[model samples]
Target: MSSVRRIAREEWRLWLRSKVVVAAALIVAVLIAVTSILTANRIANEQAQRVEQQVAAEQTFFAQPDRHPHRMVHYGHYAFRPPPPLAVFEPGVDAVTGQSIFLEGHRQNTAMFADTKAAADLGGFAALTPASLYQLFLPLLLIVLGHALFLRERESGTLAVILAQGLPGTKLALGKAAALLAVIAMFMLPLIAVAAYSVTLGERMLAAFSLVGGYFVYLCAWGAIVLAASVLLTQRAVSLGVLIFVWLFAALIVPRFAINASSAAVDAPGKIESDLIMLAEQRKLGDGHNAADPAFMQLQAEVLEQYDVETIEELPINWRGVVAAYSEAELTDLLNSYAEERMRLEASQSRIFGLFGLLSPTIAVSSASRAIAGTDLATHHRFLRESEALRFGFVQALNEKHAAELDYAIDMNRNADEAARLRARVNASAWQVLDEFRFAPDGADERLGRAGGSLGILLAWLLAAGGIVLVAARRVRL
Candidate 1:
């Protein structure tokens, strides 16, 4: 181990002395700093902005003047998803997914204000973040700097000299791999600092650690592959070319192919189709407001008997409000049924992509990072589901207010009588009692637990790749 450290130190010095390598390393370091700072600041600004928007939405909802309960329902609400605490470190799927949703009566809305869509609207590309810099680019940098590790030693005739000096080929290869790991640590420092800060703040610490672990294993895997290629191949240039091709195929091409294949494998229902189905299902519930409709009349009769009243006019409750509440309950069920089905299908697609991780460990690591950070499709679906729950609760609160506070006479005569219209307006304070939509992210432990299998695959790849390098190093020829 001491000899290995000495070898690593000597090789690192060689890297430092190479002007071209030094310059490349410096550029990569600068890029890391710039991306870390810019991404942190940008994500923080967006988080604060979303919080402000949420506050404004709540304030506006509760500040409305006296109005009919149904009017308030139509007035609607806005809900925004605050990016997860660790999301800036690994934004994952949030870039393309929408961030905000509008909640209203009789309808479900897709998340709007997506950064990807906004970028497209602006006629420019979406900016890449530090996550991509870490995941995609840094590995390529490793290939550039270290792909010729063993090959260069062989080419320069140092293998015989080192072996003749009593150093084994395995130790030489391990030493070079160690040197590369040391360099990789420099590229990883920014992420380490971020994760450390997250831990101190007690913000998704498990997920943060899991994300860091996954990346560590992923980079180690790349190091192993680079070293293996350098030793197994006959020439330095060919080694570099082979590693670059591997990086391109594994990191770039295969994931794209896997995504295309997964999309084909799953039948994810589109938003429009899901909405149409929900609407059709809701329409089957009949005219809830029209008490003369047989279905509603039956409901009205049941309610009248339940309340021990002979007519709705003497029922001491607004029949319209009762009908609205019942209708909303049924409509909400339909909404959930379709939403859940569509979400399940979409999740199936994501799962299919995950299975493709076997072909490209990059996919496995990427999925693990996103899943652990609570920024994947699953977390987004959690947000949407929770938002719907909040909508139901808030809307139901209003409906209950209508039942208790609204007069049947006023509701029945509002369109015909101005005085009745004025009387139909409920207290604005009613909105104040309802809670705003708040997204409850999955616990770090839960996310970490869920991401364990994918992380395991990354570790498995690292181990397997390292084993290959070890075997190759053992058989290196003079």
Candidate 2:
């Protein structure tokens, strides 16, 4: 144990004396700090702006003159997803998933204005969010620190001297691993600080802590893999090249391939297909234009019978309002069904990517990070589902008001003059009565549980790498 501690100390001293390692560590730390500050400020500003726009849009919608409830449903409402508090630590899929979604009767709109798909390839590479930085660059830095740890010692004939001093090979390997872990700690400090500060800003403290923990484990895994490769290869240059190849494959090639494979496997329906299918289904259910249509006429007859009125004129409730309510219900059902189908498809695609986590720990880390951030595909689907529910509730409430409050006598018969006047007006107060959309962030425990399986894959990889390192160390000659 004393010898191990002495070796760890010596390795640390050696790392500090190496200008390349010191400079690389400093650069990475600065980049992390800069990214944290920039992302925090940018996300805060964007969210504030979105809130203002939503309020203004709501006010404008309600300020208009009174109109039929059905008209308001077609007019639609917009809900902007609020950015999560820990977004600074891991932007995750925020850029890939659109922030604003339109909610309306008879249609389910996909969220729009995604930053990821909007940018050119160059911008994609240049964007410096936490996920991008860590996923693409951090492993390379780990490789730089780890590739020479043992290989260089062997190359310099120092291993024989150390072995002659009676140090066990496994202990030496552990000491070197400990030294690399220290460098990993340094690389992770800024992110940990960012996570700590996120708690004070009303972020989920436990989730933020878990994010930091996950990142630490991820970087340590990279270091371990690099160390194992260094021990396996006899030439320092060969070890460096092999480690770079490993980093490239794990970090870049594998993830891109997984995404492509998932995309190809499921073939997610494009927006056009979804829109056309929904339109066709809506028409099949009941187009308001054909009041004489069998479905509409049957609904009208049922509603009249329910009220025990022989004539539509004698009905206590406004018949038009009743028709609107029935139609809205049918529309909601169709849209919800279509939305669920799309969500299922997307989930299938994500599952394919999740399976790749076993092959590349980077995939596992990326998946875990996004899940914790609440900006992954699953969260986006949830937001869309909740938004649609809210839309249905408000639209249905307005439709019911049309049936209960409006006098059927005046509303049923339409003279050209009265029709124009009615078309031009509605109770603005009705709009004010509708609830605003709010996105609830998932609880820390829920997020941790969702990400737990992926973390298990990562841990499994680490243990496997550790085992390999053990075998390599035991086989080392002098």
Candidate 3:
């Protein structure tokens, strides 16, 4: 162990003496700092903005003047998907999938105002965020600075000299790994500070720690791979080429391939296509706007029989309201069914991508980071589902008010005259019956559970790399 420490100190001395290596490290450190601060500020600003918008939306809904219940249904509401506390660390899919949804009767809207288009406006490399730096650039930096670790020593015949002095090969290997770990820690300082500050953003210590830990494991795995490559390869140039290729393949190629593979595996329908299908299906159910349509004649007959009345005019409740409520319930079910199918297909695609992690630790760490930060597809879907629930409940409450409160005489002639329309409107106070929309994210335990598979794969990669380094170290010779 003492020998290992001495060798590690010597390696550090070499790094400090190399001007190019030192300059590169400084550049990365500065990038980490800048990206962290900028991202933090952006997240804080968005969070505050979303909070204000959500409040305004709620207030506007409750402040509307008396209007027909169906009118209130069309008036609708909005649900803003708040940024998770740790979103500063990992934004995940929020950039592309959007952040706010418009909730109204009989229609389910996709999220709007995603940052993807704005990011493109800035430039493609605008994604040079802190998370991207960790996942892609840091390892490349390591390969550039340290790919010659063992190869240079072997080419200079230092291995024979060191062995001649009775120093074990394992110590040299472990020592080089220690030096690389120190470098990794140096690059991780900005991230570590961000993680600590993340605790203050929310009571999510488990998630924050898990996030940092995943990155740590990921970087260490790279370190181990670099060590093994340096020793196993015969020439410094060859080692550099192989390590660079590995980095590119693991970080870039594998992820893209996984995405393509997943898309191929699951032929999920596009949004417009899905909407067209749903609209066609809805047409088959008849025009909900017209209760007198032959398609709803059975519903009218059922309502009349249930109320023991000869006609809709003599029935107890307003016929339009009953039809409105029934049609909405059916339509909502249709929307939910489609939503469930879409979610299932997406989930399947995600699973297929996760399986590719076996080929690249980068994929594993990326998945785990998003999952633990509560910014993955699952979280986004949770927001959509909860928002839809709120929409349905509010719409149904309006339907109930339309049935129980409005006079049928006024409803049938609501458009007949301004006076009749005025008579048909219900008090705006009725909207107060609906509770405000508040998204409840999954618990920390659930997030950790979801990330368990990726974490396991990362651990496996680390162990395999470590094992290769250890076994190869034992056989090291001049």
Top candidate when judged by TM-score against the true structure: 3
Scanning candidate 1 in windows of ten residues, the lowest lDDT window is: 117-126
C-alpha lDDT of all candidate models, in order: 0.82, 0.79, 0.86
Tens digit of per-residue lDDT, candidate 2, span 1-478 = 5877777789989878999988987888788778778777766666666677677767776776677666787788888787777776676666767888887766677788634323453465425787667776888888888898888789999999988888878888998898888877876777778787767667787899888888888887887898899888998889999988887888788999999999899988866688786786677887653445677888877877888888877888767677777887887787777778878988999989988988788999989988887767888788888888878877778777777777766664444576654753347787775677767568888888889988888888888888888899988874
lDDT of each residue in 84-116, candidate 3, tens digit only = 877887878878788999988999998897444
Q: What is the lDDT of candidate 3?
A: 0.86
Best by lDDT: 3
In candidate 3, stretches whose alpha carbon ends up further than 4 angstroms from where it belongs are 114-121, 124-126
The C-alpha TM-scores of every prediction are 0.95, 0.93, 0.97
Candidate 2 stretches greater than 4 Å from native: 114-126, 412-415, 418-426
Reference-based lDDT, residue 319, model 3: 85
Query: Where is model 2 poorest over a 10-residue stretch in terms of lDDT?
Result: 114-123
* Candidate 3 lDDT score at position 345: 90
Looking at candidate 1, what is the lDDT of residue 334? Answer: 84
For model 2, what is the alpha-carbon lDDT of residue 401? 75
